[model samples]
Structure formats: structure tokens, C-alpha cells
Target: MVEPVDPLQRLPFGARGPLLDHLSRLRHDLGKYVSLQVRWLGASPPPEALRQAMMADLLETHRGPGGGIDAPTVWAGLRPALVGEVPLDDTITVDLSGDVDFERLDDAMARISGVVRDLRGGVDGPQTVATGIEAARTVSDACRALWSRLRGG
Candidate 1:
């Protein structure tokens, strides 16, 4: 049962840059819309605009001094010697002590997951056929620019 070892895997995580940022490589399915012929329906249509927010951008924008994606994920695989029977707000308390905002923390995490899900599968935004075609080109150009600390025009 011998197998070859991946040289990339042997390197520390930091040594691997965007090589492991699979997030970017995920599938992006672009949805499309078009006008219908002889559609004189008088009902007000639902708002065509979609609220597209980049969750990671908000996380990294450091108007404050220190910034990082602090979540329970970092405390994962924690093996405490004991599990308490105590309950905090109906949640089973663990032997390990941490933040009291467990409820809100979970919600925050779900939001990040949702944004990632949408980005991977959902279309970026609404566009006509011609615009959608143009979007494919513009998107490729934008993605190539890596975010940096420098602020400029």
C-alpha cells in the first residue's frame, strides 16, 4: 500500500500561498435574464437589484488596529479532559472556557458560509445577455489583482 507523497503538502501552510485558496477555484455559475416579448403585464415587478456583499472584504478591512477572522474554528479539535453537565442558555457547557457570545458567534459564522456559498454558485449580479458576456471578461481581470495594504486611486 505504498503511495507517493505530495511535495506541496510537505511544506508548511504559510509556504503555500493562494495555491491552497480553493475558494477562488470554486465553480461560478452565471445566471442570465432577458426581456420577454408581448409581456404587457402591469404588475410592479420585484426589485431587479441584488445585494452582493463580499464577506471576506469586510473581515479584512482594518479600520481598527488588530484584525483577524476570529471564530470557534480555531479552537476546533479541542480535546478537554472533562465535559461539564452544566448548561449555558440551554447550550451544553464544555470544560474549556471561552466567549459568552456563542449564540451570536454561530450566526456570524453562518453568514460567512452563506456568502461563500453564493459566491461559488450564485451569479454575481443581474445583467442582460450582452452585459453578462462583458462581465465574464471584466471579472477575470478583477480577480487577478490581489488585495494589498496600500490605499490608492
Candidate 2:
């Protein structure tokens, strides 16, 4: 028997705007965190309070309503990247180590930026929806790549 398809896999092409918007917002938030982390590289260890605050802010952003995007979906998209090849807890965490690979982080940010740029190109209707779905997938893949590099996988 053919396996049943997931409904989410069939999200209508016209309904992609919210998902795209969520990703765009996520990209913006992550960009800020990455930038801050990069700036602190090779400097004294980042303050524990600052790290905690940043994590809280990032979590808030992820949990906030993204027009229609939900937290579980976002986590699902990011899980592969977050966990890498090794199985690990699904909690969202980041490396605050000064030895982080900034280059890879920048690359991931660039990919996200590209998606946002593409989606904002004035396309409308079904075309925009299609673009949004593609953009989301691209960002997810970028995250996976970034995580792999970060973990030295």
C-alpha cells in the first residue's frame, strides 16, 4: 500500500506567505545573534547574563506567531541542522564559544538573506507562494549545512 502523504506536505501553493514571513523573521533574528557572537570572537568570554538574555530573546522570537507559522514546524525544519549526524536532544541551543566557525555562520545567514530577498521581489499569487515554499526549504538546507560545519561533521 502507498504510504499516506502528510497534509503539511500539501500546503497549498497560495498559502505560503505566512511560512515565508516566518522564515524571514527568523533569519533576521538569527542574523543578529550570529553578528553579536562574531563580534565577541577572541575577546574575553561573553558575559553569562548576555548569553542567557540572547538565548531567551531567540527563543521568544521562535515561539512568537509568524503570521501563521508555528513553533513545531519551525523546529521540524531546523531539527536536522540542530542535531547533525549524531542523535541528540531537540532543544534549540547555540555555541557561544569564541572558537565558533564564523565563516559558516555567515554563509548560513547569507542563504537566509537570499531567500528573503527572493521572496520580496514583488512576485504575487501562486508564484509568490511557490517562491516562499522553496525559500523555506533553502533556509532549512542552509541550517543543516551550517550545523554540519559547526560540529565538524
Clashing pairs in 1: none
State the lDDT of candidate 2 residue by residue for 1-153, as single tens digits.
977543223433442343344334445544333223323443554555434332332233253455433222443453333223322233322221222333343343344344344434643344433333333344444444433433342
Scored by CA lDDT, what does every candidate get? 0.26, 0.37
Model 2 TM-score (2 dp): 0.27
What digit string (tens of lDDT, one per residue) describes model 1 on residues 8-105?
Answer: 23433342333223112211111001011101222433323212112222222122355433112221211121123343223323322232222222
RMSD of 2: 19.2
Using all chains and alpha carbons, the TM-scores for the candidates as numbered come to 0.23, 0.27
Worst 10 residues of 2 by lDDT: 91-100
What local lDDT does model 2 show for residue 150?
30
- Which parts of model 1 have CA positions greater than 4 angstroms off? 1-100, 125-153
